[model samples]
Target: MEQFTEVFLEFINSWGYFAVSFLMALENACIPIPSELILGFGGYLIFIGKMSFSGALFWGMVGGLVGSLFAYYVGKYGGRPFVDQYGKYFLMKKSHVDSAQHWFDTYGISAVFFSRMLPVIRTFISLPAGFAGVNLYKFVFYTILGSLPWTALILYIGMALGENWQVLRTIGHEVSIVFIILMVIVVGILYFRRKQKR
Candidate 1:
């Protein structure tokens, strides 16, 4: 993993902003490039004046949209049987894709909006969205909308920690833990509110 991380960092170092787009695109396309590292590293560079935050963020989103389109096409054309046959190459299984599909089905469009803020679900939601054949424009709209804040937050985390982006990892994990707790509390409140109204 360290060797791979070094190679990835080196690639980004050589190419500048385009490297962030490429890696982020690959990540959204099911290649697992770790956006945290990419954005965080970009953030560090911004601190050093090597890259602009907006430029990094813009290309990151563009690359993500492009990669998502690729995956969407794949899932739309390939379907479950194709995934069942070839998913292993992407380090995936039918079950993983199925779980993503189930989430998409259960939650409808909001799933697309929120999934971009989550981890595993963010990666695979495009598959089921494609398979289900949701409106293309709406998918693009919601995807970009959902992705913007996440991209900004990740980049900010990266920038804040500068060269010590690993520290951002700990920060991200803690944030996720807190987010989950907050979601639980919010849901409980809503549930009780509904009961009282009834």
Candidate 2:
């Protein structure tokens, strides 16, 4: 992990803002690249005068939007079968798709907006949204809206922490784990309840 972090940091350092867009794009594409690390490091750069807050925020959001659209299309065209059959190669799971689908089913279009603020759900919700055939413009609009605060908050933490920005990455990672565990338990309960109803 340390070595990976070094490589990731070096990549961003070498490429400047483009790295922010590329890395964040990969993250939102459900590639698990860790936005916290990207944005946090971006913040640290801002502190050192290597980046501007607005530039980081703009590029980060752009990357997120692009990546999400990519995932959305994958879900729209590929649908569930593609994910079920080939998702494992990308570290995706049927359960993840199901959970995202359930959230969309339960919450409708608003789920797209709100889920973007969450951890695991934020990353996976685009897939189900695409699969559900949600309006493209609306998805893009809400995606940008939902991502703004999260991107800003992480970047702010990174900036405030400066050289210690990696701390946010560590904390964000732990928080994501907790959310994943909680999601699993909720999925398990819901599964059992449905079984009981059947």
Candidate 3:
């Protein structure tokens, strides 16, 4: 982990905000780039006076929008049959894809906005939004709104924590893990309860 952190910091330090933004955009598009690390390091850069807060936020948002659009285009052009056929290879379930499509249908552009704030789900949400035929302009607008604040928050935490920035990174990872676990437990309990009621 330390080696990975060192390599990441070196890359970010050398490449600066552009690298951070590009990686962040890729991360959002399910590239496994670790958004927390990028944002945290970016924040640390800001803390050390290497970058500006607004600059970080701007690039982060741009990266997010670009990455999301990549996924959206994939879904739009690939269609449901393509996803149903190949998504499993990517560890994606048909039901999960279907659910996201349903949510997009029901909530419209707001689904894009809200999903961007979510952790793991945010990565895949844009595809469904596109598949559901959300307006392109609305999609971009809400995606920006949803993503900018999320990016800003992570950056702010890093800046505020300063030398203790690692704590924020640890907290982000732990919280995401805990949240996923709790969600699984809740789903399991609800499923069994529904079976009993039936």
Candidate 4:
């Protein structure tokens, strides 16, 4: 994780706004890149006058939106078939896929909007939105709306902390760990319940 962070930082340092956009795009495309690092460091740059807040924010948001659209299309066009064929390899079953699809159908707008505020879940929600065949316009709209606050918040923290920007990175790391553990526990509980039902 540290290594990946270093690499991303190096990219941002050298490439500036383009790096922010590119890295953010990759992050939102279901890649493991963390936006916290991207925007947080960007905020630091803003504080130091190396980068502008509005420029960084705009590029970051645009990149995220573009990546999300890419992932959404992938899920819409290719996800269902891929999941159907190979989901079991990833501990995903037809029922699980169906449940996810149903959940999106039922609560897609809120889910898409709120998930963006979360740490880990935000990165991958686009795929499910696509798989559920959510309305494109609605999906895009909520994604933009949801991502704005998160982007702005992290950037603000980075800028506010300035020289102590690493603090936000540290906090983000810990938060990610907690969320990951909780997710694992939830998945384990659900897996066990499914086994019992079977």
Question: TM-score winner among the candidates?
Answer: 1
Per-residue lDDT over 132-157 for candidate 4, one digit per residue giving the tens place of the 0 to 100 score: 78899999999998898778878888
Ranking by TM-score: 1, 2, 4, 3
Model 2, residue 72: C-alpha shift (Å): 0.6
Instruction: Report per-prediction Cα RMSD to one decimal.
Output: 3.5, 8.2, 8.2, 9.8
* CA deviation > 4 Å runs, candidate 2: 1-3, 173-198
On residues 1-198, what C-alpha lDDT tens digit does candidate 1 reach at each position? Answer: 344888888888889889999998988887766677778788888888888999999999999898888888888899867877887888775666777888899998778877777766777888888887888888899889878878888888788877686676556656555655676698799999999999
On a 0 to 100 scale, what is the lDDT of residue 190 in model 4?
100
The TM-scores, one per candidate, come to 0.86, 0.84, 0.76, 0.76
Give the whole-model CA lDDT for all candidates, comma-separated.
0.80, 0.86, 0.78, 0.80
Query: lDDT tens string, model 3, 94-123?
Result: 666666677677877788876665556677
**Model 4 TM-score, 2 decimals:** 0.76
- Between candidates 1 and 3, the one scoring higher on TM-score is 1
Query: Under the 3 Å rule for N, CA and C atoms, how many clashes does model 4 have?
Result: 0
Q: Looking at model 1, which ten-residue stretch has the lowest summed lDDT?
A: 169-178
> RMSD, model 4, all Cα superposed?
9.8
Cα miss at 140, model 4 (Å)?
Answer: 0.8
